[model samples]
Target: MTVMRRTGWFTKSIAAAGLLLMAGQASAALWSITYPRPLSENDLRSEYPVALLTLALEKTGVKYSLLPSDRILLQGKALRQLKENREVNVVWSMTDAQREKDLLPIRIPIAKGLIGWRVFLTTKDQLKYFKAVSSTDQLMKMTPVQGEEWPDTKILQANGFNVYTVPEYPQAFSILQSGRARLFPRSVIEVLNELESDDLPADIVLEPKLALHYPTAMYFFVNKGNATLARLIETGLERALEDGSFDALFRSTYQETLDKLDLENRTVFELDNPSLPPATPVNTPDYWLRPTRQE
Candidate 1:
């Protein structure tokens, strides 16, 4: 009876040791995730998104090593790499029909819908022109410029605005300097940071009192078959939302942005995005930031 008891105890000890080893291995399996590298040293707009991604991963208790791609690839190239699962595993962009078809979206708006809230970057010469604009019709009279491949160009065109397709991104600002394009509509977060950079020509300024608003989501997308990571990030984001950490992070990062733009008092010109995926959670009242617009 004593030997039988000793054998049972040894078996239990061995099982416990194996369980510990498995747990240790699980903890050590680091998820090496790659994101797009910054285009320039002054490109600080990625700070909040990267920080938010870090916060979500921390909430999941998953050992992750978030790193940028080795090369500075454009948004289009980086997205292609993500689709191929080659250099990048993740990317954040506005959800449209084509993108939704190619990648698996986490379906959570990383920017809380601020991705669609646009504020114009104008030149001093166009200041008086915008100041008199009281409605979307009046605003559409001026030529608006956007990236050739950006969904905003289509949205603007569909809404009856004569939009110019910029040949290259860097030249978009120069277009404003040359007085060819009157407005370059940028997201509220993006415009603020770009204005802070010394690279912007002195003639550029933020247009006040008028904002172009739309309902859209910027979602993190992975390879179509990479459902595991999609689930992991979505789960982490949901957990953060449940505990209010997500709200905390957004408010802390963007409170100043709202204050600077004076969004509450601006007259909003709401537009429809024809390319938005039908699966977007635009109807989920709790999933977005519905700011109180003056219009």
Candidate 2:
């Protein structure tokens, strides 16, 4: 009887230990992060919030893998894969209504607001044409390259402006430099960096007056189904913010880049006129626009 009782106790203990081991293995955190490609080494090394995010994840002892998609649009595919629980777990800075349906947005901002500066640049001959327009309404009559997905695009289009949507920043700059477009609307800091580079024409000058300003918050997105991982990332991000690690990372990576562009002296509010009514509120929840369902 004593032998039988001891055997029963040992069997139960073994089963319990096995269950605990399986649970621990299942709960082990592993994440995959997908980012947009054509990524330069400089981008990885110096870009502010993203670099900070990468560093913070590493510090947290979480196991993660990064996959770079060759084009911006392919990021959507990666996001969808995350939604389907296909091993992908995270994506950086994506903005599409369809993507929000399945992915949980980490409410914390990964970067500062999306700052856009609207300016009219012209050759010495056509300078007078832009000088006469005192307000955005008058400025809209001229040809401008509207950067796609930029919130400012809607504001311009609503005011009866003929906005030519371009695929990327380089193309928009090309249009402006080649005289295919008269005015180029872009992030002032980003454009200033390009202008200072060897690629831009020396004759072209950016106008002093900004036409519009847009301040938008950027976010990190995680798959809703992966609730445990999402919670861990969110908590980790908030901890980073509170501990000042994020600020340190931002200064180290982005400040030098800004200095090279001659933009270190500029404040975020100055680049994107903060007084503008359309600027998104800081820390607001992600506003996902839903698609209409067909009957």
Per-residue alpha-carbon lDDT of candidate 1 for residues 1-295, written as tens digits (9 for 90 to 100) = 0001125888989855754664465467888888999878888878887888888888777798999889997777877888888898989887788888888988888888998999999898888888789988899899998988777888899999988777566789998888889999999878888998877899899998889888788888899988767766776787888899999999988889988898888888899988988788766665789666433
What's each prediction's TM-score?
A: 0.88, 0.61
Global lDDT scores for all candidate models: 0.82, 0.53
Predicted structure 2: clash tally: 0
Clashes of each: 0, 0
Q: Candidate 1 — which residues are off by over 4 angstroms?
A: 1-28, 293-295
Q: After superposition, how far is residue 235 of candidate 2 from its true place, in Å?
A: 2.0
The predictions' CA RMSDs to the true structure, in order, are 9.5, 12.5
Candidate 1, backbone clash total: 0
How many angstroms is residue 63 displaced in model 2 relative to the true structure, after the best TM-score fit?
2.4
- Candidate 2 error regions (>4 Å): 1-29, 39-46, 70-89, 94-103, 116-133, 148-152, 178-180, 196-205, 223-229, 253-295
**Quick one: best lDDT, which candidate?**
1
Error of 1 at 147 (Å): 0.9
